[model samples]
Target: MAKYLRNLTCTALFSMTLPMTAAAEESEVQDMSDPLAVYTQAGLGYTDKGINVKVGQTYDTGSDTSMGMNVLEIKGFAGEALGWNGRGADDSIDSIRFRNFTVDLTNGLGGQVDISWDFDSNQGSASYSFIQALPKMGMFNFYHSLDLG
Candidate 1:
């Protein structure tokens, strides 16, 4: 009877050690840099009982930093004004545009501007524009950042 008990204890101990050894061998560390980790968003909103469409995409360059572009469409009593903004490692904004929906609408809007940034101080600035047709108005454009650490 004692010999059988000893054999059972040995078997249980051996089984437990096997799983620990396997887990240690399977452990690994991976890099967080992935260009395909981009994010996208699209939605629709009501403007004085009309429909307003919005779409945007953001790309992360790793190290808690990212860039993005946004396109908005406003349709209602008002026409529409489409705009775009982008950011980089230094948190600087550039290449802004605004235009009228009825005039040369195909080319969209075009403009050039620069945003101030402080890398060491971790601060930046953003801007916005809008278009109005009546009781309905379309305004879009902004920049924001956060610190994960």
Candidate 2:
């Protein structure tokens, strides 16, 4: 009976060891030489009374760098009221569009340019544009403008 018990213990230990060896062989990490890529997108919307606004951004990452674009649209009753009530109501009747272009250096640096335009039902419109650069640290410079028609 003691010999039989020892044989049973040896069989159980051998079975456990076999599975562990097989798992290790199957789980080895592969070598990867290609650059990694990533992509991202985001959207935001807000509404109050007759006003509605929406904004969205997207980015694409490549081998050693990345780039992105942003879009914003403003419309609805709130926009209409503000456009009409404000000094530039006539040109504000149509939708307002904004766009941003950006680049990522992949070395902890990047830059961007933004532009915007407002349209009216009567063919009148206004536009403004700006550009910015990135620094290693501290506050970066920015420029902006507004056109009331």
Candidate maximizing lDDT: 2
lDDT of 1 by residue, 41-137 (tens): 4444432222334443433334333233333333321112111111112222222222211111222232212233433455655443322212213
Range of the 10 consecutive residues with the lowest summed lDDT in candidate 2:
31-40
Q: Which one is best on TM-score?
A: 2
Q: Residue 110 in candidate 1 has what lDDT?
A: 22
**Candidate 2 wrong stretches, greater than 4 Å:** 1-50, 61-64, 76-93, 106-117, 121-132, 136-149
lDDT tens string, model 2, 1-149? Answer: 67446545543443231111112143544222111111222223222222445455454545346556565656543333322234433323245566554544454333334444434443424343333333424444332333223
All models: lDDT? 0.29, 0.38
TM-score of each: 0.23, 0.37
Residue 37, model 2: Cα distance from true site in angstroms: 16
**Candidate 1, which segments miss by more than 4 Å at Cα?**
1-38, 60-65, 69-149
How many residue pairs clash in all the candidates, one count each?
0, 2
True-vs-predicted CA distance for residue 113, candidate 1, Å: 8.1
